[model samples]
Target: MILTVISAWRSLLAVAGLSLTVEGLYYLIRYLKRFRERRPPQVLFFPAPVTCVRPLLLSSPGHCNCSRSHRESALSCLTRLLLSARRSLDVCVFTISSVELSSSVLAVHGRGVRVRVITDSDYMALAGSQVGAFRRAGIEVRHDQDANYMHHKFAVIDGLILITGSLNWSAQGIFGNKENVIIIKSTDVVKEFIEEFERLWNEYDPSNYSFSPKS
Candidate 1:
């Protein structure tokens, strides 16, 4: 008796413990499967509305604008993001003279990234000497003469990350000026910019330029 009852109670506890362990594992697997299925797949197209909308909703409070310190932090984040990119870099800049920024862009080009730069003709002419270094490093530069100001400042990386703001690629713009830059993770905005750039690319013939080393 008493010994037999104790043995049976011990056996029952062991069976219950084994059953709970199995059930816990099953539930864990089910939760993991559900989490994986609910996750959104990666987007390869420009202007992915889902990413754009999510960021827009999140940024509505400040509209992606930050203070000077925050801007620097954002720029640092943007730089790291660009460095992680492996495919292509497209920039439409109104002003670009910072050696550090230029060096960063060159580093990406050296890693076999295709770089296309579009800027005002006058700015290109002013930076004619430096543009050759970029071309020699395998980056293509395009001068836009259509816009009255060519005031756009945006860089699209790998068709996913778009960095746009009042921050020019100038030393002053990066350090001195009160610039606010947005690191937009939107494919749709990038695609729209790419198409717009292609229209300008088709219009502007590179042959007429006597400034670039490629010319």
Candidate 2:
């Protein structure tokens, strides 16, 4: 009778261990199935011949070569934007004084790129020489400093990339203090910026726009 009771107890313990093992496996399988269903489907087929949906190239402010002075990383991003520009370049700014940045504009013009600049009236006198260089390069530069205190900073490149921010084209803004900016690579965003630049460019008459040199 003693031996029979011991045998029964061992059988019960074995059954309990097996039951727990099965329960644990059931929960694990359920969890794995749920996780698999939530995962996104893999696309094995290409939508546009595998080449059209090509990788979207991206570059941030720190990737490009910029002057060492500016803390906002605007110049670095601006350099990348300028390098990526093709066909056309549109810039709308409130002030302009940075030689390196202006030289980037001039360089693009020299490459047969169409460059258009919209500036503020306050600095048109100071920007005369730079503007002349743009004109000499067959680039168009206009100012609307009189229109509601124009204080915008946007640059549209090739009708595709848009760079808009609080950082002006000035040396101080680019290389000095903290500033905010957005570099948008979406076509829709670029179109919106282009439209805004053109609207402001047309509102003011360049014929009546004039600036007198400092006395």
What lDDT score belongs to each candidate, Candidate 1 first? 0.65, 0.66
Model 1 — which ten-residue stretch has the worst lDDT? 45-54
**lDDT (C-alpha) at residue 196 in model 1:** 72
lDDT of 2 by residue, 1-215 (tens): 99999999999999999999899999999989866544432111111111110011222223324333333333544664676677988988777676656777877777788888987766666733366666777777777745465788788888866777777666566546467667666565677888888888787657655556546
Candidate 2 accuracy as TM-score: 0.59
The top-ranked prediction according to lDDT is 2
Model 1 C-alpha lDDT per residue in residues 38-120, reported as the tens digit of each score: 44433222211111111222313334433322322433554556666689888778767766457667777877888878777
